[model samples]
Target: MAEPTTRPRDAALGSGPGRVLLTVYLIFAVAAGARALVQIATKFGEAPLAYLLSAVAALVYIAATVGLAVGGARGRVIALTGCSIEMVGVLVVGTLTVTDAAAFPDDTVWSRYGSGYGYVPLVLPLIGLWWLWHNRPRDRA
Candidate 1:
């Protein structure tokens, strides 16, 4: 086998549009994490479900941000999983909060399709997925 070159074979994941995605994920990670922490610390008893969901959302955002920053095939897979879960979480949580606000009793980052966050949470995953796909490595001719 030929010696491998140190130069990057593919573009860095965080290059170009991925940078924007990474920034968004970072913002979400911090925002959601802080919110979850405060809610859990200040009033867990009042809305355990919502607060727990908030923590989960924060974790997902953190994972996604890290994955995107890491780059490469493994990172893409990790980010893909995180984005998929985030999309589902937002949809399910958004619906639950909308259909029956009584159960949640509080808002999470995903509440109302991320209405609190200007619906960016609702749309971020889709954008992330597209960015991943757009940047997927292809066989060199």
Candidate 2:
């Protein structure tokens, strides 16, 4: 009989520290998505850009959370993609919100580098990338 396949300890997605990470991501996903839904449903015209950006941020968070919770090669890729875009989004949006406050009269998840959410938005991507890298697939001899 063939031995069962198993991943390394670090490759566990929803285990140990990954469980904490997953929980946090889930929270943000709900918060950002709900906020966006409310903003768009109630007063999108008041701040269309902010509302749309919030929606996009919500999607990214959802993707990241799902990917991490479903750990595998595909999951790693998804998580990495989501995390990468998240980092870029936070950097660009943070700069825009700071340099041109008028452009962003309202807040998105990335606004002020995630200051509205205690900066977890800014740091989450970095940690996600690290997790992905740590669990990266190894070449067999």
Candidate 3:
């Protein structure tokens, strides 16, 4: 009979600190998606770019949450990509909104580096990337 392989301490991404990270991602997914939906439904013309960006942010958050919850090689890839995209999005959008407010004309979740949400939008991806690295898969040969 083959011996059972041991699971690493950091094997499960949804365990320990990962739970908190997952919760935050879920919350942001809901908040950004809902806000974007409402804005698009009522007054998309008011700030189409901002609303669309918020929707995109929400999708990224949702993907990250799912990746964390799933917790495997595939999950790691998904989470990594999502976090990378989110980090870039926040930086680009935040810079644009600050350097030229007229370009945005409205706030997305990442506006001013997420000043509206206490900058969680700005920092969450960094934390997520770290968490993903911490929980990376190990070879158990």
For model 3, how does the per-residue alpha-carbon lDDT over 46-104 read when each residue is reduced to its tens digit? 99999999999999999998887776677788889999999999999999999999989
Best first by TM-score, ranked: 2, 3, 1
Give the per-residue lDDT of model 1 (tens digit) for 1-141. 999754233336435676777998999999999999999999999999999999999999998998788877777888999999999999999999999999988899999999999999999999988887777888779
Q: Model 3 reaches what TM-score against the true structure?
A: 0.91
How does each model score on TM-score?
0.90, 0.92, 0.91
State the lDDT at 141 in candidate 1: 94
Q: Residue 138, candidate 1: how far off, in angstroms? A: 0.8
Residue-level lDDT of model 2, residues 1-141, one tens digit each, is 999987655458546888888888899999999999999999998889989999999999999998887787777778888999999999999999999999988998899999999999999999989878877878888
Best by TM-score: 2
Model 1, residue 76: displacement in angstroms? 0.7
lDDT of 3 at 44: 98
